[model samples]
Structure formats: structure tokens, C-alpha cells
Target chain A: MNLTLKVWRQKNSKSAGKLVDYQVSDISPDMSFLEMFDVLNEQLINKGEEPIVFDHDCREGICGMCSMFINGRPHGPKQGITTCQLHMRSFKDGDTIVVEPWRAAAFPVIKDLATDRSSFDRIIASGGFISVNTGNAQDANALPIPKRQADAAFEAAACIACGACVATCKNASAMLFVSAKISQLALLPQGQPERYRRVQSMVAQMDAEGFGNCTNTRACEAECPKGISLENIARMNRDYYAAKFASEEEV
Target chain B: MSSFGKAFSSSIGKKLVVGITGLFLILFLIVHCFINSLIFLNDGGETFNLGAEFMAGNWPIRAGEIVLFLGLIIHIVQTARLTYENRKARPVKYAAYNGSANSKWYSRSMGLLGTLLLIFLIVHLANFWVVSRFTGIPTHDVNNRENLFAVMVETFQNPWIVLLYVLSMVSLCYHLLHGFASAFQTMGWNHKKYAKLIISVGIWYSIIISVLFAAMPIAIYTGLIN
Candidate 1:
């Protein structure tokens, strides 16, 4: 297969970027989107040109290492998968793909197709942890978590922090991402001790990062590789307001 | 920040304000729509006139009008600020994209619909509310009511004015379609089983209320009840 690529090229966040077109031939249908990029980069290197830079680590969808907005949609046209998991087969032989980095005030561009996602990391670090040390791994059954609650927590935990939610959101909000993290812990018995502080801290950090608000458009969930539910957002809102009110009562 | 400070300061906090005020305005719409629907009694505007007279004369209802306008003003102001912030959040533009594919067009165009409604409100208030309340208007001969029903009939007589009212209701429909459930969601008012109910009700409420309001002007202009 052959395809044309219009990829965003930039020297750094300080510099302007533009779409620089390239064409590749003899692409295998089974090749992942990144692998196709690899073939393109190999051609660029052979011609003594700078290879396009993009972020990727696990190459599987789980690591959340890959970040690319392909043809407008985050992660790509095929729903519920990361850019690395996207196969060249999803496109026609002569298809033209437009690739760009996630555009958000919080996530600044590093270079071609890569943006600084440390803003997400900061939000997670704010309070996305359970500091309580459960001394030993008792029998998994010892925790006695209700099956439904445990399952809900697991579902919320599936968020990969890929920033696709922000990329897809009209407001560029990280509410889904933050809410998923909050809900993951907020649902569990183990997460109860610091629940109020956790939500308050994380939400404050999220706001301080310059992320926008959630209007509940659900685009993030639609574009999410993990299929994280918007229920997590509602949970976060419930918890955040609860925390705020509790703080007010204390005063 | 204090709790209220945080509510006013942060993105979600500000959204909470919009949601609260939006829900209040939604309630106001239901009440307003109900009163206007009374015109359909076809009682030669007698029933509608009594309802209007009661609404205008009651001190509690008059006080509610103040609260309703306060909520509406807050909603409009906060939403305008949020829209500005949202626009700035994406300083750079997408070179190629389809916004409608992700969400409904009405959901994305709240600002435009809101502005249209604002203009409609000003014109509406200037046309009837000012005359009925501040300025002396012709009173009903039989019961000495404010004759707001007569005011509405005469006001909607112009085809241009009727057209404007109809257009405003169209904007109202789209606005409420997105606003109803959105307000609850922002305020975290949801349940697993109940959210579906809430959203379905919101859609229907938007359609029904807008249709009812829209019908009033169109009905009055066409001599349907006269």
C-alpha cells in the first residue's frame, strides 16, 4: 500500500509549525501506524532529512505512551484504541493522513507529534495515591470489597492518562482524566481515609494547570482507548462538592 | 480559596454556577410556558388574563421574578466568561476536523444561541413588560386586571414581531436541549439508572416547552384565538 502523510513539524514549542507532506510506498497492511511512520523515517534518514519525532513506548495501547491526533480525531478514526494500535489497514491504499499533536494550553508541544504531558502527571501526583500501607498481601478475599464497587473501581482505573480526553474536549479539559483517577480510588474502601483531601487537592491542581471545564460532551469517553465512562466525572463532581461543603462546615 | 471562592475561581466551580443558574432558568421557562399555554383555553383570553393578573399582582411572584432574572444574568455572565476561557484554551486551531461528529451542533453553539435569546429577551421586555409594569397600559374593562393578555395579543399582531418570537423559541429549543441535563451533570446530580431518565426528560422538556412558547406568538398572529 502507499499513503500520503501531512504531519505537523515543529522545532520546539517556541517555534511555529506547519504540515510537511511525505509519501511512502510498499507499506504492509499489518503495519501499525507507528511502524508505517518508522518506514517513513527510514526513508527520511536515507535522504539525510530529519526524521519526524513522535512519542511511543509500549506500542501497545495500555502504556498510554503514544500521543497523536490522526485526521482530526484523537488516537484515530477507529474508536477505543491508541495511535500505536492503529493499523495501516484502516486506511485505503492512497489515503492521505493528517497527523498533529494534542492541542491544549496545559499540554505544550515538544516537537513533531509530541507534547509535554507532564501536566497530567502533576495532577496525578497531587493526590492520586493511597498513602496507607497495607502491610501484607492478605488473601484477595480479605478486603471484602463488594463485587459491584470493586468492579466499578477497576473500570475507572483503566484510564491510561493519554490526554486524548483533553485533545478531544472542546474546552481542552482534563476533567475525565482527573475524574477517572478520583473515582478509581474514591470507590474503594481503602481510598476512604483521605477522600476529601484527595479530591480537593487533585481538582485544585487540575484547575491550576490551566485545563478547561467539562461540559459533559463525552467526546473523551468516545475517543478513549480504554472506554472510560463519564460516570467517573459525575463521581468526581459529587466528591468534589462534598469535599468543598465539608471544608466549609469545618470553618 | 474558600469553598465559595473555589466555586467562583476554578473551571468546575464556575461551571457549577452556570449549571445552578441554568436549572433555575429552566424552571422559570416551565412556569412561563404554562401560563402562556393558558391562552389556548380559547376563553376569549379571560382565563389567560386572570392568570396574568395574578402573576403580576402577587408580591411573592413579583419577588420570584427578581430571583429569576438574577439567576439568568449570572448564568449568562458566567457562561460568557467560560466561553472566553475555552476559546483561549485552544489558542491554536485544528487544521482539519469535524466538530459535529463529536457532539451535537447545538451543544457546541450555546454562545450563539444565548446571544440570540438575549436580544429576543430585550425586545420582548421592551415591547410588553415595560408597558405592563412601569408604564401605564390599558386595563381590562370588566375586571380591572393589568390586561397583559391584551398586550400580548396586540404585541404579537405584527408579522415581523411574530416571526421574531418564533425565531427566539427556536433558539430556546436548542439551548434547552443542551442545557437541561448539562446543568444536572455539572452539579453531579446523576444516578446510574436515573441519568438516562434525566437526559430523556430534558430532550422532551426542551421540545415541548419551546413548541408551546413558539405556538403562542404564531397562534396569536394568525387570529387563531381572537
Candidate 2:
């Protein structure tokens, strides 16, 4: 297969960036999008040109690092899949693909197509955990969480902190990401002790990090590799409002 | 507000304000659309004009308008504040890509559309209410009643004015299409079983309001309803 790639290129975070075009030939349809990039890079290196930089640690889609906004849609034309999981078969010969970094002020470009997603980390760190020290870990039967709540918590916990939610969001809001974090902790018996504080802290961090407010678009869930539910966002809203009102009553 | 303090204050407060205010606006749209639909009743403008006059002068309607205004303010302010705060949060993006196509175009463009709707509302009120009340136009019909039909017809006759009205109504529909379900979800109404129901309701509500409202001007323009 032959393809024309218009990839976003930036020297650094402080410099302005633009899409640079490159052409590759003899690509196999089975090659993943990242592998195609590897071919492009190999050619660039052989010609003594700077290899296009992108992020992808595990090509298996587990690491949530393979990010690309291929041909206008994120992760190419496939739905509910990661870039690393996307294969060249999804495209045709003589296709001109336009690739760019996620367009959000929150996610500044580091190089070519790589963004600083540490804001997501900060949101997670804010209160996306159960800090109760069980020392060596609790017995499996210690506290019985209802199967429903446990499952819900697990579902919410599936978020891999991929900034896809932000990148896909028009406002670049991280409400889906933040809500998933809050819902994970707010759903479980083990996460109950600090439920209010957990939502409050995580949401606060999300806001402080410049993520936009959730308009309940559910685009994040649609594009999520893990298929995270927007229900998590609703739960987070309920929890956060409950905590706010409860705290106000205490005052 | 300090970063943490500001965020903490806005998180819950902003959602509540936006939700409540959004619901109020939705209610207003429904009522407004219903009243406007009465023009189709073939009463020769008597019933519709009477209703419009009543709405403009009735104490209850006046009070409702005030409440609607307050809701608009809360909705706009909270949206602006939350948007500003969220912009400050991430400051960066994730490494690998594949997440943009999942969302609706309207969902992402709500802020932009909402701002346009706000501008439209100001123009709408100024043209109809202000002219009727203070600008010294013939308010009453042959029966000494406010001839709202004439006002509406005259107002919608200009191609430019009708164009603006159509554009604004389109913006309003887009805003509501995403916003309706969002308000429901924010209140924890996101059961998978009920998700389709909420989405359908959002679509219907948006369609009804936009079509009904925009139809008034088009109807007048085409002489379908005088």
C-alpha cells in the first residue's frame, strides 16, 4: 500500500508546529498504524532526516500510549479502538492521511504528535485511590461489596487515563476522565471511607488542570479503547453534589 | 480564588447552576413553542395575539420571564466559569491518539452555540418586547388589543432578520440536543437501560423547539400563516 502522511511536527513545546507531509510505499495492509510510522521513521533515518516522533510503548493497546488523530478522526476510522490496534487495512492505497496532535490548550505538544498528559496523572493522584492501609492487603472476604457495586466500580476503574476523552472533547473537558476516577472510588465498600473527599479532590484537580466541564457528550466512551461508560460520569456528579451538600449541612 | 479553592467552589456549584438553569430554559422553550404553535389554530390572529398580549402584560408571565432571565444568567455564567477553569487543568495531551470521533459535533460546540443564542435572545427581546412597550408602535389591533400577529409578520419579513432567526434557532437546537441528556446524566440518570430513552427525549425536545420556533418566521415569509 502507498500512503501520504501529513503529520504534525513541532521542534518543542514552546515553538509553533505545522503538519509536514511524507510519503511511504510498499506498506502491508496488516501492519498496524504504528508499524507504518516505524517504516516512515526508518526511511527518514536512512535519509539523515529527523524521524517523526510519536508515542507508543506497548503496540498491544494495553499501555494507552499509542495516540494518533489519523485522517481527522481520532484513531483513524475505527470505533472503540486504539491507534496501536488500528491496522493499515482500514485505509486504501493512495490515501492522504492528515495527522495532528490533540487540539487542546490543556494538552500542549511536546514534539510530533506527543502531548504532556501529566494533567491526567495529577487528577488520578488527587484522590483516585483508597488510601486505607490494610498493611499486607485485606482478606478477600473482609467486607462484602454487593456484586453490582463491585462490578460498577471495576467498570469505572477500567479507565486507562488515556487523554482521549480530552482530545475528543470539543472543550477538551476531562469530566469523563475525572468522573471515572471519582466513580471508581465512590462505588466500592472499600472506597467508601473517603468517598466525599475523593470526588472533591479529584474534581478539584481536574478543574485545576484545565480540563473542560463535562457536557455529557459521551464521545469519550464511544472512542474509549476500554469502552468506559458515561454512567461513571453521572455517578461522579451525584457523589460530588452529595458531598458538597453534606459538607454544607455540617457547616 | 486560589487554584484548589476555586476549583472546589466551582465543581459542584457550577454543575448545579448549569443543570437547574438549563432545565429552566428548556421549560421556557417548551412553553414558548406551545404558544407559538397556537398560530396554526386559524383564529385569524385573535387567539394568538391575545395570548401574546397576555404573555407580555400578565403578572404571572412577567414573573416567569424574570425567573427565566435569572436562569439564563446562571446558565451563561456557570458555563463560562467552568469552561475557563477546565482550560487551566490539563495543559497537555496524551501520547498516542484515537479518541476524537466518538462525540457529537453539537456536544463539542455547545459553548460557541450558547453564546450565539444569547446574542439572539437579546435581539429577539429588543425587537418584540421593547418595540411593543416603549418604541411607540401601533400595539393594538382593530379591537384595541395588541396585534402580535402583525408584529411577528413585520418582524419576520426582512430576509436578513429571518436568516438571523433561523441561524439562532439552529444554534439553540444544537445546544439543547446535547444539553438535555447531559442535565439528566449529571443528576445520575445514566442507566444503560434508560440511556436510549434520555437520548430520544433530548432529540425530540430539540427538534420540536427548533422547528416550531423557526417555522413561525418561515410561515410568515411564505404567507402560509398571516
Candidate 3:
């Protein structure tokens, strides 16, 4: 199979960029999207042209590193699937795919389709963790958390810190991503100590990093490879308000 | 503290200002609507005439107008400031993209609609109040009541002006619908069991106010409920 690719190329963060078209031939239907890109890079290298650069580590879907806006939807046509997991069979022989780097003020283009997603790292650093003391590993049965609560926590934890939610959101809001991190921690007993502070800090950081406010539009969830629920956002809001009260009480 | 300092000191403080100012503007709408609804009271002559009389000359009414003007200024200024802050906070990417379909339409476009509503308000005040007060137009009725109903009738008679009014009303409805629920949310009123119900009620109220306000001019123009 052959495919026409329109890929966004940028020399650096400060440089302007545009979509450049490329043609690839002899693509195997079973090849993963990244593998197909590998084939294209090989062709580019053979022709002495600069190879398109994109972020991908561990071709497996768990890393959340492969970020591409294929056609228009993030991670291509499949729902709840990462770009690395997408196969070339999803397209036809003569498909013209428009690929672009994630265009968020928070995430600037580094080169080609790779973007600097360090803003997400900053938001996490603001407060995406618990400050519990280090100790011997506790028995799994010691906490005895409710099954429903445990399940919900696991679901929230499924967020791979992928910026797909940010990339797909119309307002480029990171509420969904930030909310997922907050919700996962808030749902657990171990995370209870810092729940309020976590949400407030993360949200403040998100806003500080120039992410848009959430209008409760669930587009982030729709495009999220992790299928993170919008309810997580509401939970974050609930926690933020509660945290405000908790902090005041502490003061 | 400076006025700017007061607003920027905290998120909650900013939200409080926006909410109070927003509710104040909403109060003006309720009063304005009640007065206009008097057009349907007593054959479109007696009640409207009396209402306009009070609005134009009554000392108490004059005091109310002064208070109302303060509310309008506060609401517009705070809203503008909040919008500016929100814009600055927004990420540059996906700025042109659409949000989730589940979000309220008004939530995303409030700034645009609010601007249009402001423009309409200026036109409304200029065409009726300013013209009647300063130009010495014969705008009063037999009892020396300001004939606001006549002004409304004349304004709606022009199809182009009526079209503008309709568009403005539609935008107002959009603004109110989102603004209503968002006000409650900012005040931390998120009891899920009742949150959805309250938001639905907000939507209904918005629709009713918009329909009633928009209907008045259309009805008068068509001579339906005269």
C-alpha cells in the first residue's frame, strides 16, 4: 500500500513551520503507524533529505509518547487507542493523511511533529503526587478499600499523561488531564492527606501554564486514547472547592 | 487596595465580583421586563403610560435608574476584565478547534454575545431615552407619561431594526443560559443530584426571558396582541 502524508515541519520552537507533503510506497498493511513512519524516514535518509522527527518511545501504547494528529482526530480514526497502536490497515492505498504537531500554546513545536509537552510536566510538578513517608510495602489487604472505589481509582489512574486530551480540546484546556491525575489520587486512602492541596495546586499550575478553562465540553474524553471520563473533571472541581475549605481550616 | 488589585488578589475574589455583578445585571433585566410586560396590562395604554411616567420623572424611579446605571457599569467592567484574564490563560493551540459537543453552546461564546448585547443596549438607550430626553421629542402621552411603548412600536416597525433586535435577543439568551448556571457553579453549588436539575431550570428561565423579550417587539410590530 502507498500513502500521501502532509506532515508539519518546524526547525525549532522559535521557527515558523508549515505542512510539507511526502509520498511513501510499498507500505505493508500490518505495519504500525510508527513503523510506516520509519519506512518514510529511511526513504528520506536514502535521498539525503531531513527525516521527519516525532516523539515515540516504546512502540507499545502504554508510554503515551506517540503524539500525532492524524487526518484530524488524535491517534487516527480509532477510539481509545494510542497512535503507536494504530496500524496502516486503517487507511486505504491512496489516502491523503494530514499530520500535524500538537498546536497548543502550552506545547510548542520542537521540530517536525515533535512538541515540547513540558507544560504537562510542570502541571504535574505543581501537585500530581502524594507526600506519604517511605516505609515497608504494606499488605495489600491492610487498607481494605471498597471495590467500587478501588475500581474507580484504577480507571482514573489509566490516564497515561498523554496530551491527546489537550490536543483535541477546542479551547486546548488541560482540565481533563489535570483532573485525571487529581481524581486518581483523591479516590484513594493513601492520597487523602494531600487531596485538597493537590487539586488546588494542579489547577493553579494548569491555569498558570496558559491552559484554557474547562467549559465541561467532553471533547477531551472523546479524543482521549485512555477514555478518561469527563466526570473526573467534575470530581477535580469538587475536590478543589473542598480543598479550599480544608486549607482555610488548616490556616 | 487599587480596584485592579481587589479583582486580581484571588480567584475566589474575582469570581465573587463577577457573580455579584452578573446577578445585579440580571436584576435589571427582571425589572426591565416587568415594566415592559405592562404593555399587556390594560389595553397597552394605561399601565405602560403609568410605568413610563414613573421611569422618566418619579424621584424614586430616578434614584433606581442611578443605581441601575452603577450596576451596569460594574457588570460590564468586571465581565470584560474576567474575559481578558480568561483569554490570557487560554492555551494557544486548539484555540480555533471546537469544544466537546456536550458543553452548553452559550458557555463557549458568552464574550461574543455579551459584546453584541452591549452594542444593542447602547442603541436602545440612544434611540429612546436620549432622543426623548434631550431632543425634546414629543415622547410622552396625554398624562405627560413618557410614551416608551410608542417608541418600541416605531422601532420595531422597521424590519432592519427588528432584525437586529431579534439577533441581539438570541445572543442575550445564549449569554444568560450559560451565565446563569456558571454563576451557581462559581458559588460552589455542585450537588450532583440537584446540579443537573438546577441547570435545566436555568436553561428554561433563560429561554422564557429571551422569548418573552423578543416576542414583545415582534408582537407589537405584527399588531398581534395590541
Q: Score residue A90 of candidate 1 by CA lDDT.
A: 95
- For all candidates in order, the CA lDDT equals 0.88, 0.79, 0.76
DockQ of 3: 0.22
Q: How well is each residue in B1-226 modelled by candidate 1, as lDDT tens digits?
A: 5577875687778899999899888888888889889999987777888888888889999999999889989988998899888888888877877566677888878889999999999999999789978886776835766677788888988999999999999999999999998888888877788898999999999999999999998888889976
Name the TM-score of chain A in model 2. 0.95
Chain B TM-score against the true chain B, each candidate: 0.96, 0.88, 0.85
Candidates by lDDT, descending order: 1, 2, 3
Q: Rank the candidates by TM-score, best first.
A: 1, 2, 3
lDDT of 1 at B6: 71
Docking class for candidate 1: medium
Supply candidate 3's per-residue lDDT for A97: 86
User: Could you give candidate 3's per-residue lDDT for residues B1-226 as a string of tens digits?
Assistant: 4433422343444555566667777777887888888886647566886876677777887888788888778767866765665565533443123343334456767778889999999988887778666875566666666676677777778888777888889998888887877666655465557688968987887888888888877887788755
lDDT over C-alpha atoms for residue B41 of model 3:
62
**Preferred candidate (DockQ higher): 2 or 3:** 2
Task: Please tell me which predicted candidate would have the highest DockQ against the true structure.
Answer: 1
The DockQ-derived docking category for candidate 2 is acceptable
TM-score comparison, 1 vs 3, better candidate: 1
- Mark the 10 consecutive residues where model 2 chain B has the least summed lDDT: B90-99
* Best-performing candidate as measured by lDDT: 1
